[model samples]
Structures are given as C-alpha cells and as structure tokens.
Target: MTNTIIEFKNVTKQYDNDSPVLDHVSFEIERGKFYTLLGPSGCGKTTILRLIAGFTEASVGDIYFDGKKMNDVPANKRQVNTVFQDYALFPHLNVFENVAFGLRIKKLKESVIKQKVQEALTFVNLAGYENREIREMSGGQRQRVAIARAIVNEPEVILLDEPLSALDLKLRTEMQYELRELQRRLGITFIFVTHDQEEALAMSDEIFVLNRGKIQQSGTPIDIYDEPINRFVADFIGESNIVEGRMIEDYLVEFVGGRFECVDQGLNPNEAVEIVIRPEDLEITTKERGKLKVKVDSQLFRGVHYEISCYDEDQNEWLVHSTKKANVGDEIGLYFDPEAIHVMRFGESEADFDRRLEAYDHGDAHEQ
Candidate 1:
C-alpha cells in the first residue's frame, strides 16, 4: 500500500490563450505531511491551491486522491476545506454559528453540530468565545474562527491560502507554531500557500518553489537552501553572492581572476558556470589572512547581525553577515571553506539536478 494522499500528474492550468498559470506540474503529497507551495505573486501557487481545493479545475492532466481520479469532483464534494487569505468569516454570525454553518448546510443534528463546533473552537484556543461577533474579534481571533470553521467539517486535507499574511509579525509567528501543532495533532495533510521564504522554511516539511507558472524546485527547506539547482532557485530562496565562473577541471573553478577548489565534479573542462556563496558562510579577517580581498562599502546593524556590503577588485558586490564590525572604506579579507562553493549550470532540469546532487551525496560524482 502506498502512503500518497494526493498527486498531480502533468497538470497544466491555462486560461483563454493567456499564459498558462501552471505548466506540466507533477508532484505527490503523502498523508499527514505539511507541504508549502512557495512563489511570488501570479507565479501560480494560489492557482495550485485552488485546483486542489476543487474551487478551480485543471485545464490539463489529472488530479488524484488516494489513487482515485478527482477531476470531476466539486468543491463541496471533496473531503477538503480551505482557509482563505481574507479569513472569509461571516460578519453577521457569531463564533458558534459561523463554525456551525457548514454542519447546518448538511442538515446535521444540532447536538452533533454543537459538539463538533465546540471541539474545533477549543482546539484552536478559542474556548468560551462562542457568542463573540466576527466584528468583535481581533484579526488573530477571526483567523482562529475561520480555522475552527474549517476543522468543524472533519476534512481529510486542509488548504491554507496565505492565512497568516494579514496578521502582524508576532501573531503571524505565533500562528505558524499553532498551525504546525494543529496539523500534528490532527494528523491530516496540509497544503499551504505563501510567498514568504522564511515562512515556508519555518513551517513546511517539504517545499515546492515555483516561478512563472512552473515548479522551479521541490525539496526539504534545508536541501533547497544548501544545494539550489540554479541561479533562480538560489536567488529566490534567500540572499546569495552569485558570480560567473569557469570550471578549469574536476573540483577546480576560476572566478574573479582567482582559482579555488570546490567539491563539484563531472562537468566539461573549461565549462562556464555560476558560483553561489552564502553571506553567513563568509568570514571576515585581515587582508593578509583572507582568500579574497574586498573593501567594505556599507554596513547596517540588523539587530541579530550586521549586514555588510563589500566590493571586490573586479567590482562584483559581495554581501556578508557578521557580528564583528568593520568600518566602511576599510579593506578586509574574506575566508570561506571550499565546501561553501555551490556550482550551478545555466539551464539544468530538476531531474538532472536532483540526479547530480544524489551522485555527489552518494560518492558517485567523485568517481567522475
């Protein structure tokens, strides 16, 4: 028996000859795992959520649930519920009525509806606020009410469409923890959509990073951050210092008039490539002890660390995160381990990229 709860087989969502919202997307979601669709606006993350929720249909390919095709399933017929970005609660109804609305529509017994609504609200820490009007609830409270309503239906899967986008930072962070815990306790699949990279990293067990109607990459947050497939995935996931480079041979790359040792292999000799070095991986030292010399152009104190900007001799910008202060206009040396270098090709497919990474991780690439 397989554990797959949901699957998209070559799904593409296009509209009226406009560019496709989703382009031949395929993925599987295991039961009880938290998955995030992460991307920028109009990149099709929300469209994916809509498709899964049955609010919209895929223009091509099939969607499956537990190996059964669900292309014809209507929104209300699917065993899934959605929490929208706007909270979508009824202003005229109090908390109890709002949460009980779904049950009432089904003509469920009042006793059963009451019991379910109570449990749902209490689980979301909204106990004893049954009579509170939607207008009276704070933004966070309204969000809780919305969630309570979704859970009241006993959904097998929940689709959260940027539900935390409206809350202030502190509340949003709190909700991240709360939502994660809720998913754990319920043991149901959660498909969340968000463009916030930090939110996706903090919450998702797996992430699908999307761009321009296509899935650029999908993996664990750590995997995406540590071994991004290309410049787009690397730059979109977080800040990086990417520079043009050339592969001199196996494990040697030349960049900025300097040759350095790296772990990557199996590329053509003298192949052009891109190098990604993370800001936090950079260590600042005296010029004499550094592998690269750069002049500090500016520095800003960012509470947790100083975000320093510098320029090398070739005028390429390098960003560094450090706790130690460096005066602007001062020349400094930057040191990074050989393993810090992540080499990328110009146009690598996800399959080839994953294969290459797996080769390196399993000691196969080293043999090349």
Candidate 2:
C-alpha cells in the first residue's frame, strides 16, 4: 500500500498583494521516503517546509498530515520536528539536556527521560558525549545533536531546512550519506529543503525541483538529472550545455551548430527548442573525426576528471567532463552518442522552465 504522509493541495503563500511565494503548489510525500524541495535561494522551498511544520499558514489551499487538516494547527501542536541550518542548539545545555529538552517539558520522570535521551544520542552516534558541551563539539556533531533532538520526540515527520549548508564540502557530502541511511533506518518521512542540487540529488528518494515559488519537477535523482523537465531545472541541477535547436521529426532535430537524432519527441513540428548536454555526456578527443568539431578554450583539472570548455563553429561554448588533457586553442573532435541529445522548448520567463519541465516526460525528450 502507498503511504502518503503529507499532502499539499493547491497550496499557495503570499506575503502581500504582490506575487505569491508559493503558487498553487500540490504534491504527495509518501511515508518512509526522503524527499527534497530543491531550487535557488528565493524559490519558496523553505516556505513549503515551514508550512508543513505549521510555522506558517498557506495563503490559499489546504495542508494535510495523515489525512488531518492542519489549517488551524500551530507548530507545537503538530507531530513534526525541524532541524534548522543553524542547528539551533541551546548555548547552556549540554548534549544530554539538549536532546532531552522536549521530554523535560512533558515533566517525564528522570529515569525515563535519561533513557530516551541516551538512546537518541546513541542513535546519532554520539554515544558517550552526554556531558560534552554544545560549543565543544564539531559542526557535524552539533548537527547530529540537532537531529537527535528532533528525533527524540519520534515525530511523524522530520523537516530539515538546509541542515548541512554551514558545514564544509567534505562534511556535507558525508552527512548526505548519513542522513539517507538514518532516514531509511528510522522508516519515517523526511522532508528536506536545499538549494544545492548535488546535495538534493545525492540524498533524496524523490526530489521536487522548485523555482519561483512553484514545483518545477519532482522525481528520483536519476530522473531529474537525466530528464530535467525544462531549462531552469537543467541549468540549476548541474552543469549543462544548452543551445537553440528545432525539432525536425520524432527522432531528429536541427540546430545552428549541427543536426542530430535524439531520444525525445517534440509536440510541435519545427518547434523552437533548446538542447542540454551534460559535461560528462560529451567525449573529447584530439583526433579530427567526429560529427561536431570544437576548439578547446580552457581546461580545469579536478581530482577525478578534467572539465574542459570548447567552442564550436557557431561560437557556442560547451563544456566536457574528460580525463584527457588539452590546452587552449587546441582543435578537438567532441563525440557524443545519439542518445545524449535533449530538447526543450523556448520559455518566455524563468518560471516557464519549470512549467515546461513539469510537462516533460521520458522516452525521448530533447533539448537543443
């Protein structure tokens, strides 16, 4: 049976008579899955989390938790907890008291509260740090304390608002894995909010790409990365080479740079479109034998691979993820299999990217 723990039905949020922050947003979050609200900084991803936590009310529409309406409910009355980006741990409380703060409010017995707090700490891998002060712990440890505090109450849902944003890259990556594992083990719904596409893609069981206060696309990481609904999602989620193109037919497209066959089909004949190619999807070679020829503009050596930039005859710049070395001004043949091409229709506004992506489906979508 499908267990949808949270539902947003035509939810919208507006601060004033101006444009709404969340506009008619609707989706279902299944229980025991890790979902991410991903987008740029002002995209209203955090607003969704806040609304779910009852921190704010929807300007329109309704929010449901376990089939119960939450319109009049307050944050404290909801069976949910939030872990903020700042950790929000008390300066005076030690690790034990911090984790046990919620239980203490209920006036629970000393023995029971101690046991629950110890279990929560142990669950978060802070096993013998009951006496450790909050300031003494590392950033990651402190973040874990935040998690422990939230989970100690055993809330029906845990909402994390960029919990790892303040940590270093290495720590952030580590926490991504840990967060996924913890969510799976706990078998609870985890609604996370982040602007980092890599972080969202790495950890989410399902990802909702939000932009301009609305959901642009929602799917697994593989789906969102491999098949972005529109240009905004393609551009936001990762590095993509975008270009203008026209759909020639079901299996073919023509563009300024070149003509190629793609997996995506277009709804309109001769539709003005955009195509996206991931850096890794492109193959670069010094040999002069490929469909598209390019001049290497620059190369960056990352630890695992080199990110090389190239420009084709149309003066359109593209990026390729390669291990091969090449210098600026080096003419090279960039090879890509037919399957790499993706097509998108030209959008009038930024939100059009999301609207287009939401309309996009697999089985050969194209970006020119």
Candidate 3:
C-alpha cells in the first residue's frame, strides 16, 4: 500500500496588516520521494515548511501527517527534523556530541546515544570525524554533520530549508548529487525548499512551483518544462519565447501575423492565447525555404550554443539557441515542428488547464 506522508488542505497563513503568505494552498507528499517547493522569496514555500515542522500555526485550514491531523502538534512532538540553511551545529561541541545532543536531552542511556550518533555519522559518511570541533570542519563537512544530527532522531521526514545555499557553486553542485543519492538510500520523504530552478529541476521527483502565495503548477520537471500552464510558469521554469496568439481551431494557431499548425487543442475558436516555444526547439534555415522569416538582431556565444535574437515583421522578438553562427542584419527562417508549439490560455486555473489537457488527450486517443 502507498502511504501519504504529508498533506496540506486549503491552508492559509496571514500576519497582521499584511496579506496571507500562503493562500489556500493544497498538495500532498508521498513517502520516500524527493519533493521540492520552488519559488521566489516570500512566495510561501518557507511558510509551508514551517507549518509542516509545527513552528507556526496555519491561519486557516488543516494539515495532516500519516493520515493524522497535525494542526495543534508542537515542533518536538512531530516526527520530522529540519536541516537549516546555516547548518546550525553548536560551535563549541564536537561532532559526536552535537549529533547526540537531542538524544541526551531525552535522557537516553549513554551507550544508546553513542551507538545512534555513530550510526548517523556513518550514514552521512562522517564516521571518522566524530571528535572534530564544529569550527574545524569545512562547509560541506558541516552540512553533512547537520544531516547527521537530524537523522539521529530517526524522523520519517526531513525538511531541508535551502541547506546548500551557503556552499560555493562547485560544492553546491556536488552536494546536489549527494543529497539526491542520500534520499534514495534512506527511503524517507524529503521536502526541500529552494528558489533555484536548476536545483529543483535536477533533484526533485516532484516540484510544486509557487508564486504570489499560490501553487502555480505541480508536476515532474519534464512535464512542467514542456507544458507550462501559463505565462508565469513558462517564464519562471526556463527560457521561453512566449508570444500573444489566437487559437484558430483544434490544431491551428495564429501569432506574429501567421497561422501555423500546432498540436494543442480544447480552446475556443479565435480565443486569445499565449504560445510558448523553447529556444532550442527552433532551427535556422534559409529565409526563402522557411515558414517564418526573421532578421537577426543580436547573438551571444553561450559555450555549448549561440543564443541568437531575431525580430519578425511584426517586431516580435524570438530567441533561438543553435550551434551554427548567423550574421547580424541577415534575414533567416525559424523552423519548428507543430508539436513544439504549446498554447496556454489567460487566467486558467490548474483545474481548467488539467481538464483541457484531458479533453485533448481523449480526443487524440479517439482519433488514433
């Protein structure tokens, strides 16, 4: 049987004289998966984490853990631990003592505490560093120590609140891999909070993209990247060439003064919509043989590919990533497949977006 580890149902959090930090948010977390709450600062990602950790009370709605309501649960009573951003180890304590502090406070036997601390350190690959003082450890070492301390409690869920934000880029990248691997090894639920899109893309089994106190979308990395529900999601998840358009029919869309075939459906005829095409999906070709003619405006060499900017007759700018070079002021053709065009309606709720997608999928299956 599949067990649900955590759930937030219509949860809202508000402070005095300010708007709600989280407005009617709802989601679920399954056991033993890596879930990331991704958004900019003040988008309520941290608030969700705090609510789950029992550090704050929700202004409205209920929270659940393992099918039990947790609205009034205290921090220490919950079976969860947090690895804070600063790796909050005691500066004066050695690694072993630091990891065993919680157990000691609970009046556990000395021998049991020692065994658990040793096991936690070994789990974090720090078995030989028990006697080292916190001040004597590197940043990565300190992070592992924090993980060790948290796991020593044997919590079923671990909350990582941007724990890698303090590390350098190289170490941060290295730790990303390590954290994902550690989660799989432990087979425990990990709820990671981050504003970094790349980190969320790389590590999350599921991602909840938040903005302005609401969850904009939730899905796997590839699902969100390829089929953004709206403009905000498209612009937030990655680089996209989004333009205003109209859905002409089930498989036709018009943008930049041309009607093009597309793979999307379930929109009203001539309904105003936005279209997104990834930069890498566009190819450059001779103007005479291309579907759309564009003039090169600028280009930047981005190591693996050149990011070229072009303008069409309607002055709509398009960003194209390609391996070949193109001269500025030259007219070129932008080629893309019908399946590459993703159509999104304005102000569509997630429920509506999902229903439309279901309709399109059912229609396609019927045809096939």
Candidate 4:
C-alpha cells in the first residue's frame, strides 16, 4: 500500500478574536507527488501550509506526517522545508552561503555539505552561479536558490507558499516546469499553495480547491476541469459558459438555449442542473447550420483565437471561442458536442459537492 505522507483530519484554525480561517479541512497527500492547495486569496490555502509547517497551531483536530502526529513539533524540528513567496534569501549572503546555510545549522561535515549544496544548485540549473551575490541574481535565479536551499536539507516534504507569485509571467511559467521536473527527480512530496488556476493545473498531480475556509473539490487537473462540482469552481478555474438547465433523464438535458443529449448518469429526472461548457469546447457556425442562434455582443482578440461574447433569446450571456469573425451585432450559431456538458448537482453545497464528486469517481471505478 502507498503511504499517505501528510494527513489533515478535521483541522480547524482561527485567530484569537476573528472568525475561523480554516474550517475542518481534511485531505490526504500521498508521498512523492505534487499536491496543490489552489484558491483565491484569503481562502485558507496559505493557512493550510502554516498549519502543516507548524507556524500556527490547529484550533481543533489533528495534523500528521508519515503517521506521526505533528501537534507540538516546532517548524524547524519537522522533516519539512518551506520556500516562501519572496524567496527570503539573506541580502547579505551570496548564493553559495545561502544554500549552505541550512546544512551548516545541522553541523554536517564541510565536504558533505559542499557536495549536497552543489548538487542542489545543479538540480535547479544554477551550477556555476554559486559566487553570485543575492542582490545581483535575477528573480528566477533567486527563487531557484531558495528552492536549492530547502532541498539541500533533504527534507521528506517541501511546502511552497506561492513561491512564483513575484516573478514575471514568462519566468514564472518557466519555473513551473523546472520545479515540477526537480520534484520528480528528487522524488520528494511537494505541497504547493497558489491562487493561479493555470499554474495549479499545469503542475499539480492533484489539486485541492478551497473557498471561504473549506475544501470545495479535490482531484487531478483534468478531473477538476472536465467535472467541476459547483458553479463557483466552474467559473473560477477557467473560462466557462454556465447554462442553467433541467435534466429530463439520464441522457437528456434541457436549457433555455436548447435541449441536448448527454452521456452522464446518476442524476434525477426533472432536476435543475448547471451546465458547464468551456469556451474552447464551443464551435462557431453560421446561423443556418447551428443548434442555437446567438447574437454576438463583442469580440476580443486572444492571439490564437477570438473570444466572442453572445446572448440567446433569454438574454443570458454566453461566451464562445472561435477563429471566425463575427462583429458585435452579428448573429451566429454556437455549436458544442454533448460531451462538453458537465452537470452540477442541484442544491449541493461546496463540501457536499466535493463529497458527491469523490463518491461519483469511486462508483465509476467500481463499475469499471
């Protein structure tokens, strides 16, 4: 059986005088995988990291690392490391000293520390920059140094707190790939916290979506994207057109725009559902060839494709991705395959939605 390296069981935390910041969050992170705590700002992603790092104590319940409870263990005592958002390098120290700082504290032999520090630097592709001053290195380089610093200590787990949030877009994207590759090479469990949906989707083996101090959903990137549990997740993760509808049967769904046949099951008849269709899932056609006619309200160029906003007879706004041209006032057809329709359960709260989605996956596997 695989080991669950990190476990949060009914964990809750709150400020001394404020409302709770984390409310009974529970999840298991497997060893040697990349897990992301993804959500909007102040949604408790960072709070979970703090709880794991022992920066903050749990208000209730328990946290565990490799079957060992982490109640009173100080941050430094835990076999864990953190790479903060700001890199947090010592301005007065060079790259070599900063990366070697952790090892020196452990009082390791100079030769072993030197070899490990060099290996960590090379793992981050900063092999020859050991002498570079922290003030002289670029943002990406400094970020890597921070990572090298953490990994050089050979911690069982590394917790990254929005470590790429400060870099330029291009650099951040590059570092995302590098960090993923490094994690795989080292075979260390990485628990990353970030608010960027694309970053989480691109890097995480599994993602935990949080909102308002609760876990909304947890799954692989494809699982979360193709089968979001609620309207909030459907809207937050990517560009999606949320169409309100009613399910008539296991294979049929009806909306104000039109009725379509789908392949999804386990839904009740005549129950209201929210249909989530990604913008890219939609195809544009002339009014004569489409299932539904919509008047284009605006079009914005997004480099490779045009993002067109439109409206149907019910005055409900819908967005379509198209390479074809349709002026602001022109009417066109929006076509989508039935497979693109994802139904959100009616009257499902965030936590309820998460549980239902997990159960659905479990049942699907059992049936298979």
Clash counts for all predictions: 0, 14, 0, 0
What digit string (tens of lDDT, one per residue) describes model 2 on residues 1-368?
A: 44878889989999989789998988888888999999888899999999998888999999998888988898899999999999899989999999999999989999999999999988889999999999999999999999999999999899999999999999989999999999998999999999888898889999999888888777889888987777788999899999988888887888765688788764478878888889998888655666678888988999899999888889999898988888999888887877888777775575655455444433233442
| Pairs in steric clash, model 1 | none
Candidate 1 has a TM-score of 0.94
Instruction: Give TM per candidate.
Output: 0.94, 0.94, 0.93, 0.95
Candidate 1 C-alpha lDDT tens digits along 1-368: 78998999989999999999998878889999999999899999999889988988999999998899999999889999999999888999999999999999999998999999999999999999999989989988999899899998999899999999999999999999999999999899999999999999999999999898877777889988888877888999989999999989989999999999998887789888999999999999999998889999999999999999999999999999999899999999999998899888756666886676556444465333
Colliding pairs, model 3: none
Output the worst ten-in-a-row residue range by lDDT, candidate 2: 359-368
For residue 365, give model 2's deviation from the true position in Å.
Answer: 9.2
Which candidate should be chosen as best, given TM-score against the real structure? 4
TM-score of 2: 0.94
lDDT of 2: 0.87
Regarding TM-score, does 2 or 3 come out ahead?
2
Give stretches of model 3 more than 4 Å off.
347-368
Q: What lDDT score belongs to each candidate, Candidate 1 first?
A: 0.90, 0.87, 0.90, 0.88
Question: Residue by residue across 1-368, what tens digits does model 3's lDDT show?
Answer: 54888988889999986999998877889999999999999999999999999999999999999889999999999999999999889999999999999999999999999999999999889999989999999999999999999999999999999999999999999999999999999999999999999999999998999998988777789878888867878999989999999999999999988899998887789998999999999999998777789999999999999999999998989999999899899999999999899988866677875565445333432221
In terms of lDDT, model 1 sits at: 0.90
Candidate 4 ranges beyond 4 A from true positions: 349-368
